[model samples]
Target: MTTATPHHLPGTDLALEQLPKVSLHDHLDGGLRPATIVELAADAGVELPTTDADELGAWFAEKSNSGSLVEYLKTFDITTAVMQTREGLERVAREFVEDLAADGVIWGEIRWAPEQHLARGLSLDETVEAVQEGLEQGVDAARNAGHRIRVGQLVSAMRHADRGLEIAELALRHRDAGVVGFDIAGAEAGFPPSRMRDAFELLAANFFPATIHAGEADGLDSIRGALTDGRALRLGHGVRLAEDIEVSTEGDGQVARLGRLAEWVKDRGIALETSPSSNLQTGAIAQWGTTLADHPLDLLYQLGFRVTVNTDNRLMSGTTLSRELALVADEFAYDLDDLLVFQLNAAEAAFLPVEDREALADAIIEGFEKAR
Candidate 1:
C-alpha cells in the first residue's frame, strides 16, 4: 500500500514520509481505501454513493468538508456499514496498519467504536477480537515489508450512546491482549465527557488511561470536562483550546496569556492530537480563519503546548500523517527540527509504558538523523 512517491516538505528534499512518526489519534472506519469499500459493500449488502473507487473517494472528501461535525459524520455510516462482518473488519484493520506503514508511521493508535459494528450479529467482545486479529496480521505484514510499524487499539465508546461503562470494561478486558487505551468519540457539542463520568471513574479506579475528544465541535467547557471528568491523558483535536489563550501586542512582539484551563494542559504536557486538514474540514478552526494559515497548530507549537500532528480520518480528509506534516510545514515554514519535535511529543503522549515511550522516541530520533 506504499505510495509510488513520498510526500516531501515544500521546496525541500526532506522526505516527510520517510521520517518516523507517531500518530496518537486516527479513526479506523474513517481510513478505508475506497476500492476496498466497493468490494466489501457488495459482500455486506450495503449501498454506496458510487461503485467507482475514485468517485467514492471524492464523495467522502466532499461530504466531510461540510463545516459541521454532525454533517461530516454522516460519511461514516457508509464506511461502518461495510465493516460489520468479521472479514470486513479484518480487512479494514489490516489495511489500516499497512497504510500507516506506507506513510512512515512508526507507531499509531487506531481508535474505533466497537458498538457501531454490531448490527451484523457481532458481540462487543467478538468485534474487538476480530479487529485485534486483523491488527496482528497487519503488524506482521508490515514487519515483513521492512517497515518498523507498531499499532494498538484505542477502543472508543460512542459519545451519543449509553454504553460508555460497558465499552470501558471491554477495553480493560483486552488491555493485555491488544487494546492499549480507551476513548469516547462521535457527536461532541452536547454530549460532554461528563456524560460518561461513570466510565471515566471506572477507568480511573483501574488506573487505565483515556483520551477524550474535546475542543473540536465543542468549546472550552468540553475541554475542561475532558480533563476533570474524562481524565484524558491526551485530547482528541483540542484545537479550540486556543480560544483560552489571549495574544496582545507588546512594545515590539506579541505576548500570549494562557487562561487557567490552557495553562493546566500546557504545564501537564497533555498532548493535543491536532489534525490540520480534518480540523479545517470539521470547522474546528473556523473561529481563527478558513485556511491552513489560520490553524492553531502553529500557535500551539510555538507556545510549547504538546501538539501532535494526525490525520483524524485519512480517507475522508484525503491525507496521511506525512501529508499532514508537509501541509502544515508549508503553511508555517517549519523545518526538520519542528517536525521531529512533533514526533517526540506524540511518542511521549503515546499510551505505552514510560520505558517503551522513551524507546519509541529514540527510534524516531535515530530515523530522522538518518534521513538528514
Candidate 2:
C-alpha cells in the first residue's frame, strides 16, 4: 500500500517519495518496522531494551549514533534475535517489501545474512525459501494495492564467521528461485575479502554477481580486496573510495586527481552505494567532516563516479530513501534532474540482467518525466 509522501525538496513542491527509486544497499535486518520488532520479540521471548515501538526506534538511533562500530553493530543483535524462525523471517521480509513499495521504490535488493538466522535450527536453504515466500506475498500485496514493486534477495555471508563458502553455494542454489546475488558483510576492518577468497572464487566461477562491504569502516586496501579477492561487481557503502582521490584548489576551482585504485573503480563504472546518514553514524565519513554537507557524495557524483544514494539502515538512521535523497539534495543544492540521475544510477547498478536493468531505467525516466 502507498504510504504518505511527506518528504519534499526544499523550495519545491516535488515530493521525493513520488519519484521512482531503486535501493541497492538497504539491509533487511536494518529496515524492520519498529512495531514488527516489538511483536516479534514478544513472540520469540527475547528481551529488548524497550518494548515500546517509538522507544525502541529511538534506542536504535541512539546506539547507531554512538560513533563506534561495535556499538553500531550491537543494534542488529536485537533485530536478528527475533528473526530466527520461519514466521519471523517471513513476516520481516514481507514487511520490508511493503515498506519499500510505500517509499516509492519500484525495485529493491534486500540483503541479509541467512547464517545469522539459523540460531533456531532452520537450514540455510530453508531460511532463503522463507524469505522468498514473504517477498512474493509482499509483491502481490503491493500490486493489489495498485503499487508495482519488485524485490530480490542478496544472500550475505557474515565476514567474522567462517561460513562464506557454504553461504556462497546456498546463494547459487537459490539463484533461480529469488536470489539475485551474493555479499559479505559484518566487521569490515580485520576480516578482509581475502579471508573469503574461496567463496568469491566460487561465485566468480559460476558467473554470479557480488557486492562486498568495503570502503566503509575500512579504506582503500579493503576496497582493493573486495575488487581483487571478492570480485565484487558493486561496493556497498563505498564512500571511502573518495579517500584515494586528491582534491586541490586551483584558480577559483577545485580539481580531483584520481589514484590508481580510484581510476580503476571509476573507469570500470563500479557503483558506490553512498548512504549519507548512516555514513555519518558509523564514522564512515569521519575523515571528511562530521556533517552531511561534508560527505563526498557530491564530489563523487560531479566527478562522474557511478554514485547512488541509499538509506543504509532506515530504522537506525531514522531516515527513508526519500528522506535521504532530500537531505543530500539540500546539502548538494541538487535539482530535479540531479535527483533523477541518482535514481538512474541505482537502476543501472542493480544486480538484474541487462534487459531488466534497461526496463527499470526506462520506467524511472517515464516517472520522472511525469513528475517534471
Candidate 3:
C-alpha cells in the first residue's frame, strides 16, 4: 500500500522496523508528535517557537543535542506546557503507543511525571486515569492497524520536587490500573534516590518495582544510592556504571576488572536501561567520549551486564527503538542474534509478572525467528 523504502538492518535485508523490540525507557511527554503539539498548543493557550510541525520537531532535536543534561531538559518545558489538559495528555499517550507499534516495539513502558501535568488544574488522579484511557485506546488503535503492541505506564516523580512519597502512592494506587512501575526522573545529580528513602521504602513494602534514573548525570555513587536506597530493580541510563569497570591493555588482549559496585550490579542482573542517543545528547556518556563508538555499551555488554537499549525521548533524540538498535549495531557490528539478546534482556527487565515476562520473551523469539 505504501512505496516508502523500509529501513533494513545493516549487512542484512531484514527490515529494522519489522524486528520485534521492547522499549523500557520511553518518555510520554518527550515523544509527542510535532504536529500534535501544534494542535494542542492552540487549545492549551500555549505559544510555540514555531508552529510548523517539521521545524518544531527540528527545534527539539537541535536544542536537546546541546550536550548538557540540564540544557537538554529545558526542551521539556515546551512539551509539558501543552500536556496540561486531559485531552492533550490523552492524545499524546495514544499517539505514543501508536508510534511505538509502528516502530516494531511489541512492548513498551511509557514514563512521565503526573506532577508536571497539573498546570491546568487537573488532579493527579485525573491525569493518571486520562493517560490510562489513552493508552488503552492506543493499544486498540494499533491492533486495528494490524500492529501488535502492549504498553504500561511508569509513573515518574520529579527528583527535584518534594513529592516523591506522594507520587509513589499515586503509582501504587493505580498499580492495578494500567500503571506498571515507578521511577525517579529529572536532574539526577544533586537529587539522589536516598533523598526519597520514604518513597522507596513505601514502594518496596508494597512489592512494587522501581527503575531509578542514575549513573547518567552522576557517577558510581549515584548508582550505589539507587541500588542501596532506591532499591531500583533497573537503572535508567546506567551508562556511568562503566566508570567502575577498569579496562586495561593486558599484552595481546584487553582485560576488564570490575569494581565491587560493578560486580554487585552485574551479578545481581540489574538491568541497565541505556539509551545511546539520549546518553550522548545529555552528556551521559561524556566521560567515555562524545562519539557513539566511544559509548561503553559494548564494554558493558561484553562484561555481561543486563544491557537493554531504549529511546529515552523519541522526539528529542529523533529516534525510535528500531533506530536505536540500528545505531548500536552500526557501532558494535552486532548481528541479528545480538539484537535479539538485547530485546530478551529488556523483556526480563520489564516490570511484569514472571509468566508475562516469559510470554513476552516467547513472542520476541518468535518474531525474530520469523525474520530469519
Q: In candidate 2, how many Å is residue 51 off?
A: 1.6
Relative to the unseen true structure, what is the C-alpha lDDT of residue 349 in candidate 3, on a scale of 0 to 100? 95
Clashing pairs in 2: none
Better of 1 and 2 by lDDT: 1
The worst-scoring run of ten residues by lDDT in candidate 3 lies at 1-10
In model 1, the runs with Cα more than 4 Å from the true position are 2-4
* lDDT order of candidates, top first: 1, 3, 2
| Prediction 2 TM-score vs. true | 0.98
Query: Which of candidates 1 and 2 reaches a greater TM-score?
Result: 1
Global lDDT of each model? 0.94, 0.92, 0.93
**Model 2 accuracy (lDDT, Cα):** 0.92
Candidate 1 per-residue lDDT over residues 104-174, each given as its tens digit: 99899999999999998999999999999998899999999989888999999999998999999999999
RMSD of each: 0.8, 1.0, 1.4
Q: What does candidate 2's lDDT look like per residue over 277-323, in tens digits?
A: 99999999989899998899998999999999999889899889999
Report the lDDT of model 3 for residue 101: 88
